[model samples]
Each structure stands twice: as structure tokens, then as C-alpha cells.
Target: MSRATRRGGTGRSLRTTFSIARPHLRGHGLLIAGGMATLLVEVVLRVLEPWPIKVVVDAVSVSLGADSGATAGLPAATVPLLLACGVLLLGLVGLRAIAQYCSTIAFALVGSRVATALRARVFAHLQSLGLGYHSHAKAGDTVQRVIGDIGRLQEVAVTAGLPLVGNIVTLVVLSVVMLVLDPLLAVVVLLAAGAYLLLSRRGAPRITAAARSTRRSEGDLANTAAETLGAIRVVQAYGLEGQRAEAFDRGNARALSQGVKSRRLAAALERSTDVIVGLALAVVLVAGGWRVIDGAMTPGDLVIFTMYLKIALRPLKDLAKYTGRIARATASGERVAELLEERVDIADRPGTPPLGPVSGDIRFDAVTVDDGHGRRLFDELTLDIAAGETVCLLGPSGAGKSTLAGLLTRTSDPFSGAVRIDGVDVRDATVSSVRGSVTVVLQESVLFAASVRDNIRAGRPDASDADVERAARRALAHDFVTALPRGYDTVLGGRGDTLSGGQRQRIAIARALLRDAPIVVLDEATTGLDPAARAAVAASIAELTRGRTTLSVTHDATSVRDADRIVWLEDGRIVEDGTPRSLLADPGSRVAAWFRESLQEAS
Candidate 1:
């Protein structure tokens, strides 16, 4: 069987579930232990609680009847005895309440801590996963697993675990007590509980299936909503709101249907348990009454026997109720476990050393790579760029210009060959070290929802305010940034949507400049800008590229003319490599034709 099949199937066993939570439990061992201890004390007190009522009943019966040998040495006035029983009953209940409170608080604290730790771990893991894993994964589905599924596990810790364990302990203690007091009545109670367990097991598979379906449907609904909202601008511009709503409604309806089926099964189990418990109680009552009338047992003895029977069977009812919760938690746990099992394909090799500062010499050594779909993009391709040299990669779309940059940044690895920086193979260096030496400014400027200063400082978190301003000034973004409402402190909306495209690009340039890395990648950075914006960004690029080994991927004639050399790629090979002016001056050259077509499109 496949790994996923084994993990998604048998990996959800009770032992596996606890293993997932074990670290957090161990971290807060004292609190969890205290909670269990408190629960155990509460259970013992509950077992003793009914005895006070039995004492009162026996005392009253002795007072009303002729004074028998059993009461010969007892107090003549039963009021004092009744009062003492009442006080003892009050003390037991009050103490039990305090224990319950402590246990609840302790368990809740442990649950919250576990949930917080798990969320952080899952989030960090997701961030560490390779781009290839994320490309095929849905954002909404991932969010559901991280948030909704983990949240369910938290509930299992507090609600399902403690209660189930506590109830089982209570039931066991009560059963032993009942058996000692009256074995025949205890046998009937045990038989009823056994039947309830059988019925619950019979219904478990269906309930589990329905719950899994419901969780999956909810994930789908979350995905649909997130996708639509993330692209709300496109959806609204294209009038797709009604369509998105219809899709969401379909998923929501399916979730509702599955949830109802799960709840119905759970409810049926609970009602069946109630009926079984009630019949057991009636049987014990009828038998004990006959024993009382025949002088075989006292009325108080009958009362205590019935009370213990109720206590023993109460957990059976709870077991039926908690079955649905456990099933839901199991489904959620499976999803979480699957995500956690995802391997980090692009991580640094074990014992890999950190790379030192680079002198900016880069080489691709007989590299071969495919586009992850068996389509070869490079085959034994070799290239070299010297220190401080600016090379422009010219190509038609899908000619693998961006793929080259991805290799340099360690975003993805070559199929069979090595990418080297400063004569050191990237695969032999720590991933962070390799990436830290390069800065990239993509076609679309990516920014978080934060102040402009923070966005620029993201390139170097330790950069001072003065350093940030200096970088922005170099990118020609200082003037506009100062004019904003809060200047450098102005908060941008998601993706920095409040800024114009050129403004965003300038900020991106400022960010790259602040990194001060030895190597830079400008991937179609000026492709979609207006004339004024392009000029501003181009000037910033010219400043940033100076003294740095830069790779410019573009079809723009201006960016090409500014490059020291142009490498024109066609069919996974370099068809032309020379000064841009030399290539453009050749009339019969494909590079010249490509440049002419690009200039014509721009005009």
C-alpha cells in the first residue's frame, strides 16, 4: 500500500492521535497531571455522595418504625442524625464542585497551549514546503487543515479526552461498588452497558464516514470562498458574483446534508442508550422491592443499589454521545497528519555548510532540467557570468529564463546538473545561505499589508529607518513616499493595492537594493509599466544593478539596450550571445527580428 493510504487510514489510531498531542502534553505535564488528579478525586467523591441520602433514609425509617436491635444503641432523636447527614452531603457536593472547576480550568489551559503550539508548527511547516507542493495545493484547503482541523484536535484534548477518560474511571469504580453490594443487580447493569457498547460500535463506521465527508465538504467550501475573495476584483469586473455564490451554496448544502446524517446517527445512539439504562433501572427497582418486602434487604439498601446502577450506566450514555465528537476529531486528525507528512523536497542536505560572501561569479555546469511535467527545458546547458557583469536574457515566452533564476535562488533544483555561485555548488551549501546571496524583483511586486517602511525593511529586517529612506531615495520612491499620509509609516493595503503599479515596482526595487546581495534578478520587472513608471523603475534598476552581478529577463528594447550583453535563447539553447547593438544591427538575425517585433508592440 502507498504511504498516504497507510497514513490516512491506520495513522488515525488512538495511539497515533495521542502521539500527535504528546509533545504539548509533555510540555505542560504538571497541568495535565493536576487535571487528571482532580478528576479522579471528583469521581471518588461522587461515588460517596449518595451514601448521605441513604443514611438519612435509614435513620427516618428507624424513627418511624419500632426501635429494632439495629437502632438499639443509636440516638433516640433522628433529627440530629438527619442534620449530620445533610451537612456531610453539602460538604461532599461543594468539594466535588471545586474539583470540577479546577479540572476544567487545568484541562482548558493545556488544550489552549497545545493548540497554539500546533498552529505555529503547522504554519512554519507550510512555509518550509517547496513551491512545487504549493502550486498544486489549494489555499483554502490548506487554511482549513491548519485552522479548522487543528481547532478540532484542541476540542478533542479538552472535551473528548478528559471526559471520556473521567467517565470510564467513574463507571469502573461505581461498577466495582455495585458488584460488592449486590452482584445480581450489578450483573444486569453490566449486561445493559455491554449491549450499549455493541450498538455504539455497530453505528461507528457510518458516523465516521459521514463526519469525514462533512469535514471535506467544509474544506471545499472554505476553498471556494477564499479563492473568490482573493480574486474579488476579477470576479466583480467579469460579473461572476452570482456564479461564485452558486458554487459556495452547493458546497454548503452538501456539508449541511452530511452534518445532519452524522448528527442523526449520534442522536440515535444516545436515545438507544437512554432506553437501555431506563429498563435496567426498572428491573433493579422491581427486584429490590421484592427483596425489601421479604425482609431480605433494607429500603435504604435498595436505594443505594439503584443509585450505583445509575452511576455505572451514565458513562454508557456519555459514550454514545461522545462517539460523534471522537469521529469528527479523528477525521480532522487524519487531514492534519497528511499535511504534516509532506516531505520538504528542496531542503538543504544534512551537514551542509553555510555559504560565505560571494564575489558574484555564477555558472551552470552541464545542467539538465525538466518543467516537472516531463517536458525538457534544458539539456546539458552551460552558461557563465563574470563578477559585476550584467547579462540580459532575451527569449520568447516559455523559453526558461525564469527557470534559470529559480535554480540560482534554490527555489527548485536542476534535474541532473549543478548550479554554482562563486565556484561552490548550491546543493552543497545551506539553502538559506544560497538564497541569502541573491535578491529578486519579479514582474509583479509582492508586498504584505504593512507600513511602507516595513515592506522595504523586509529585505533586511535589521535596517534602520535612515537606511530604508536611503534605499527608497536611490529607487526614486522617497518623494512619493514622503507625500503619503503617514510618510514612511503609511500602511498599505493587501498586496499594496493602494499604490499605483509603478509606485509598487519602485518600492520593490528599493527593497532589493536594501538587501545589498552580490547577485540580483530582475524578471520582466519593467514589462507592464506606463512610460513614466517604466522610466522611474528603469532608472532605479540602473542604480541597483551597478557593481552587482545582475540577470535581466525581459523583452523590452530599452532594458536590452542597457545590458552589457544579451543572451538570446531559443529551443533551450543560446542561439545568439553578443552586445545588444551588434545583435540589433544584424538584419538577417532572429534576435534583430525579435527586438523589432517587441519595439513595434510597444509603439
Candidate 2:
């Protein structure tokens, strides 16, 4: 592989991202105008600084050697002219200062807004992307691109982009004024500029590369931190805090080192520019002094030439600084674009119809699922559930019950064959439709940091307070919820840690009940509950499953006993299919043996 390709930075050309950002550039109109005004004011003030020298020189020359009446050649308004020039120069300088201040404010305001808008757009796009895209990516890395990297791009918009234009105009205008004074001196300044541009161009890519490396490492660091924090419980339990901390420190150190390298390159480029400018000034001074001694150029013209040279070189210094900032911004922008370009693996197909409403019937036809590892989760399994039927899935650990449940709700897609709800293939239905028609209550209930009522009502946003209370009561969660300090309005903290495991699970059941979907999959929903809570939850499940297609993956005999049909699975295949009564009665059956083992384990 090419070196760039090996670096994982070769897929998209940088220019394409810039092209996409062209529309956003329009946001800087006011900033650009303000910058132009500032440059013009600065050049006009610089151009006037040499006028006082000319006035003093002429005034001295006339007093020393001119004929007494040569006052006719000089304006009788000499004192007035000198005073007026001073006033004008002061006025120009003041205008320059004001314009400079306005430019800074304008550019900063517009640039920050543009950066924020761009980031929002990128984030919105990322959300639309497929799960397959996010699976191999890190959450922290994605957040870094959206937040940190996009923020860096603001410097380019404010400093490099606008100022580059403003400086170029200033340089051209000043160079012309200098040429009108002394062409030879103007040539010297242009030569310095040429050298500076050449050096800056050669250095741009190296600096950009270093900046890109720094940004990428920072993203990796963010990913490490987020990953560690996300699984803090696991990390603590496994005594992995030191190992994770070391990993994060290493990532942070790498980023810091790369940042140092980028800064060093930028500093070198600036120093080179300063050296070249200093050399050019020396050359101009020597040449101008010779011309003055030879009487070829007046001292006033020499003074003007020097002023123009200084003004011309000032922008070059500005450009050097802006160049480095631009490189960093480009690097940041490219990283953000990389994330925004990702596509989601699972999404509603184009032209797919809404599921509208579904009956409880479910069909799995020769369905097979691959776990993205080479292992098959299930192989060509076929099953049918009549409307409002309650079924139990009995499986050994790693027997693919959770995978099957995920497939039912379109959390994933089958590798071959299909899963249908009410005879409609899930893939052919809109995601909203499928999700609305089928809901799953996971083994571990997730509760947001909200009031108890809000948590239960989230499953159906339109649900009223009365409806939420009804659902909670049916789930057997109302009594405890009402006992909380604030009852239904009580806020749950830290994923509802204030409640016991059984309480959280009961709240989840309330949420599922509120959803009112035609099909429900309860996967180990009662696993962590105590005996009393487990029995109460099972009763609620029985009540809720009265008129829905229910698929329960469980080890609880009470839950299994309530199933109309029991499907026993082993090694990703259905090993037995029969009514629960028959399966439990068969002594030789794996389902019966597993049931007995679970009962023994529970006891």
C-alpha cells in the first residue's frame, strides 16, 4: 500500500471537502468586507507617513538655499499644509485602528457561527448514517470530529481565508505606490515576497500532515476515554483502571508530541520568512543610500520607498501565521468530513411503505443470521406464530435467542431468508413502521434521568398521565413509584440506581406496556428480579400478552409454563418444538433437562 493509504488518509481528496464547504464561505461576506476596509485604511496611513519627511526636507532645503522670494514656489500656506498633513495622517491612523478592531470582531463572529453550523450539519448527517458505519468507529472519535475538530476550522475562516484576500490586496496596492516612487526598490520588496511564498508553499503540506496526525491522535485519545468511561463498572470489576489509564495517557502523549512537531514546523517557516524579509530590507537600504548619495533619488523618495517595503512585508508575516492556522483548520475539517461521510448499515429502504398497523402474527422463514464474525447466529430456521399467541424460547447460553429477538425488531438483518410481521417482510417496511409495530424489553432495562412518569411515557410520547399511571399499575410498578418522595414526578438518578434491579425491570415492563405494540419480545426480562418481584412481573407479562404475539426468552419455569408453545434451541438451531406441557413431560428432552437444571440452580 502507498504510504498515504497506509495512514488511512487517502480515501477522499481534500479538495472535495473544500468544494462542499464553498456554500458556507458565503457566511463570511461581512468579515471579508470589514477586512478589506481595514487593509485599505492601514495602507493609506502607511502611504502618508512619508509625506511628513518630504515636508520637513523641502522646508529645510528652502530655508537654507532658495532665493528669498522663492516663497512663490512654496505655498504661503506652508505651516497650514504641515499641520493639515499631520491631522490627515492621524485621522488615517485612527481610521485604521477602528477598522482593524471591527475586522477582528466581524471575522470572529461570522467564523464561529459558520463553524457551528457546519458541525451541526455534519452531526445531523452522521445520525442518518447506518449502524454498520458506527460499529467499527469509536464514539469518542466521532464526538471529537464533531466538536473539537470543527471548532479548529474557525481559525481558518477568520484568519487565513479572509486575511489572505485582504493581505494580497494590500500588498499589491502598496507595491504599486512604491514603484511610482522608485521602481528598483519595489523590485527588491517583490523578490522578498516571492521567496516567502515559495518557502511557505513547500512547508504547507508538512505542517498540514503534522497537524492531521495530531488531530487523529487526539481523536484516538477521546475514543479511549469514552470507551473506558462507558464500561467503568466492568473496568473496575476487572481491576483494569490502571491499564486503561495508561492506554489513555499513551494516546494523549502521542497527540501532544505530534502537536509539538506541527508547532515546530510552523515556527521554522515563520523564522525563515523573517530572515528573508530582513535580508531584503538590508539590500534596499544599501541601494537607496547609494542613490541618495548620487543625487539620483531624493531623501523623501527614499523614505517613501522604505515605508512601502515595510508595509509590503508586514502582510507576508501575517500570511505566514495565517498559513499555519489554515493548515491546522484544513486538517480538522477533513477529520470532521470523514465522520459525516459514513453511511448507516441499517435504514428503511427507499419507497418502502409504512407498516400502518400490524396483527400479532409473526413468521420467520428459513432465516439465517451471521454475527459479523464468521459465526452464524442461527441457520435457516423457520417458525410461525398465530396472532395473539404466547411462545417461549428456551435456549442454552449463546444459543442466539437475543440475536433472534434483535432480528424480530429489525435491530439487525438476516444474512439469508426473511423475518415478517403480519406477513410483511421487515426489510420491505419503513423503520418507523417496524419499530412502532414491534417492541422488545431487554434483559437490562435502560432508564433515562427523568421523572418516573416521563420514563414510562417515553415508549409512547402521546401517552397521557392517566395512561402512564395505568400502565405502571399493570406492570406492578405503581406501588413503589408512588412511595418515592415525589411519586410519579420523582426523578431517577444514575440510570435509576435509586431503585432496586426488580423495580427498574418493572418500570421497563411499564414502558413496554405503554408502547402497545402488536408484537413484544421479552428477553430475560425477569432474570435479575427477586422471587416475589419475579412472580409479580410474570403475572404482569401474562396480563400484557393476552392479545399480542409474545416471544419470551427465559429460564423461569413459571414463564415457560404460561407459553402456548415452547421452542427449545441449542447451538443456533431449534432442537425441539412442542407445547410446554409435552416438552416438560418428556424426561429425555433437552428442554426438560435444561428446565430442571435452571430450577435446581435457582433453588
Candidate 3:
């Protein structure tokens, strides 16, 4: 399996996601304050700009009227009022412009900070998860959650969150302005807003659902591509290129179809909102005109009311524009929440004392393990190896030899018994110390896309270059490694494709040697090597495992005969355990038959 990337969920609601994201933004106090201030200023400007229109209308009406009083006609008194209105309108517009600029900058800063912190936190949490959790999850799905999902949320929080507050405030301010100008027309606009809200409530759920499906399909597509690329060799070996491509195409088509559905709902919502706004304007115009003719309302009042009605619909329009982001954010937040809530299977025990260095002696007592599938892996299995003895386990392909090796290193804890190292139960010791004392080198050696020297040093990061070269020499990899164009510094592509399988395994052995652990486990170490290569690797293992407690699982007769003792496992049971000479001398022994078959298969 590839390393952990990130984990998140896909959800279908907006309010839940925003509430979940609140904690991430709680630290950005200055940004929140600035954005709120800008929103307030923008609303104030929306209300003030229309008063000037009212002023111009009143000034024109009075100037052309037949009235004679100072308050009724265009007298010298009207000049100061018109001039003050003009100046106030210009000043508010300038303030609104500055506030809008500040708001944008503040939101961008806050969004970046929040997204960075969340991604880092998620990455760190993933590191704490156990091997079992990682084994079942995909690297691609996790990567999307950490980078793409969180990034989509940043856009949502900035575009949807701040504007949500601003638009609602603008609507309220416009309502108050209209009510003060003419209450009857304000009632008409209010009714129209109620209708808009009702329609939004009716359609919002469907749009949100469609958006969530699209997001999930996109994530599935990402996982499919990642899995196919990682297993490109296997895919090509089986001639499955077309099959993988078809799977990806299916996922992509599903996402596109769902996205189209969401877009259609959003478009319909917008058209309906526009229709309501236009109808409200017509009603208000007719009512206000009648009141003006009856001398109950001024012509200035009618113009101001019309502007207020338009301003009130601004929130609904903002809602329309942000609908898609709100839906996507809801999905991303739910995904993140699900990942954060997962319990880590492997974690530190409470009040457990730290374990220091360990001796090489190993023992398994009543070591019964189940594969979690209601089948026994090993039943009542018990064994022991002295501090410096090398033991080889020989068995057929289905004999649970590899499973027994895994139990020794605590890669998995046995179900019903104890795995002890130097007389201490591995469960009683700290996880890192237990792992540090034992290392396993498997058949498929993993090499990162880094320089050969760095890949070797992964076993012991603090190892010097000289120590690394010495370890490589001991593993029989030094000569071949030096032959490369860049030698030790040569960068290897994924899984070290530039090198042969035997070379990769040798590097892995060198890495294990650098670790200098007292207990070493090798699983089918040279199973895939040629006869000459196997001889070289077997000799290297013998030299490196000197004076260490080594448990080697092999079907190779050469490795078996080289061991101090050979334990024959059959159906997860130890059928025979003795020195190699004694086991091989008995022709009827299962260990002898298994070794003969392995040698024949190699030939």
C-alpha cells in the first residue's frame, strides 16, 4: 500500500459544514472584524445612494411646482439641501469602495491561513493512524481530501460565508429605508421577499443533493486513476489497460451528469428570483404613483422606494451566485469530519512506561491468531529462539509461515497470547521501542523515488555516508550500485525501476543492516532471484545476521540447510523442529519433502 495522504467525507448539507469549519477560523480575529466592518459600510452605502436620487426627484418636482412657500417650492433653501445630498452620496460611495477592498484582502488572508492550518492538522492526524487503517484506504482519495477538498472549502468560506452576512444585512437596511419612505410599498416588497424565500426552501435541498453526488463521483475518479497508475505493471501484465480506462470514463461521466443537474437547478432558481424582483418593482411603482397623485407621498419617495426594493433583492441574488460553493463546502466539511472522527486502532497505552533497548531473545506463548475472517491462522503455536540463534521456518505455500513471522515483529498483535522479546511482553512495552528492536525485510522491497543513498539511509536516518557504503558492501549491493551512472547519488525512479529485483532486495537488506536491530525477520527473502543471485543474497544474509536472533521464512533448501535449526510448519502448526541434519536425514519428514519440492521448482 502507498503512504497515507489525507481522509475526508462527502456530505449533503451546508449549515452542518459551516458549523464544523467554525473552529478553524476562530483564530482569525482581525480578519473577521474587518470583514464585518466592510459589510456594514457596504449596506450603509446601498441605503444612502438612493437618498440622492430622492433628493434630485424632489428638487425637480418642487422647482416645477405651483407652490409658493419656502418648504414647498424651489427656493434658496433647496440649494443647500441638494448640495449636501450630492456631497454625502459621493463620500459614502468612496467609503464603500475602500471597505470593499479591505474586505477582499482580509478574507483572502484568513482563508489561506485557515486552509493551511487544517491541511497540516489533517496530515499530522493521518500519520498517527495504524497500518491496518492505511492498508484499506487509497493514497489518491486521501490526497484529494487534504488538498482539493480543503481548497474547495476555502473558496466557499470566503465567497459564501462573509457575503451571507453582508447580503442579509443589506436586505434589512433596505427594508427599513423603504418602510420609512412609504410603508405600503414596503409591504409589497416584503411580500415578494417572502415568496422568494419560500421558493429557495423548496429547491435548495435538491440542488445540494446533486452537488454532493457530483463531488463524490469526482473523488472516485481520482482514486481510480491513482490505483491504476500505481499498479501499471500488473495492469499491463494482464492486458487491462482498456478495462481501467473504461472504469475511469464511467466515473467521469457520472460526475459530469450530476454537475449538469446542479447547474440546471441553480439556473431555474435565478430566473424565478429575477421574475419576483421585477414583479415587486412594478407593484411598488404603481402604488407609489397613486399615493403621489393623491398628495399622500412625494415623487422623491417613489424613486427612493424603487431603489430600496432593488437593494432588498441583492441578498437573494448573492445567494443565487454562491449556491454551488455552498453545496460543495457542505460535502467537503462532512468528509473531513468523518475522517477526524475515526478511532486509531494502534495508539500509545495510557501510563505505559517507555521501553529502552532490548536483547535478541524471542518467544511466542500460546500464540493463537485469527485472520479476522473466522478462520484460524495459527492455533496454540509456541516457539523460542535464543539470543544469538538463527532459525528458519520451512513450509508449503499455504502453511502460514509468513503470518507467523509477522506475529514475531508485532506488525499485528496475536489474538489470544503473548509475543515476548527478552522476557518482556511486546504489548507491555512502548510501540516505537518494540518496533525499533525488530525489523522485517520482505520479498517486495519498497524504494522511494529518491537518490539511492537516501533510500538506504531510510533505515537509519542519522547514518553517515561512510556507514551507508559499508552496510551496502555487507549486503553485496555496493559493487552494482557503484556501476550506475550517478553511483550512490543516482536518483532511482518509483520502486527503483532502474535496478533489477535482486539489486532492490539487496538495498533493502542493507537498510535493515543499517538499522542494527537485535532481531531480524526475512520473509521469502530471495524467492524470486536466479540461482547465482540467490547464492549471493543468502551469503549476504548469513554475514549480516551473525550474532543476531534471526527468523527467516524460506522454501529454499540452501537457506534452510544453512540455519542452525529448521522448524517445519503445516496448517499453522509446528510439525517438526530440529537441527537441519536431523530433519533432512529423515526422508519421511515433511520439511525434507518441502525443501526437495522447492529445489525442484527452481530447476
TM-score of each: 0.95, 0.85, 0.88
Model 1 lDDT at residue 22: 72
The TM-score leader among the candidates is 1
Model 2 stretches with alpha carbons more than 4 Å out:
1-20, 23-79, 97-109, 176-181, 234-239, 294-300, 482-491, 536-544, 555-558, 570-572
Clashing pairs in 1: none
Better-scoring candidate (lDDT), 1 or 3: 1
Q: Over the stretch 338-427, how does candidate 1's per-residue lDDT look in tens digits?
A: 787788878878899999989999999988888889998889888999989999998888989999878999888899889999999999
- Expressed as tens digits, the lDDT of each residue in 340-369 for candidate 2 is 555556687779999866887888999998
Tell me the deviation in Å of residue 435 in model 3: 2.2
What value of lDDT does candidate 3 attain over all alpha carbons?
0.80
Q: In candidate 1, how many Å is residue 243 off?
A: 1.2
Each candidate structure's count of clashing pairs: 0, 5, 3
For candidate 1, the 10 contiguous residues with the lowest summed lDDT are 1-10
| TM-score computed on alpha carbons, candidate 3 | 0.88
Give candidate 3 misplaced runs (Cα > 4 Å). Answer: 1-12, 15-23, 64-90, 408-410
Poorly placed runs, candidate 1 (over 4 Å): 1-13, 66-77
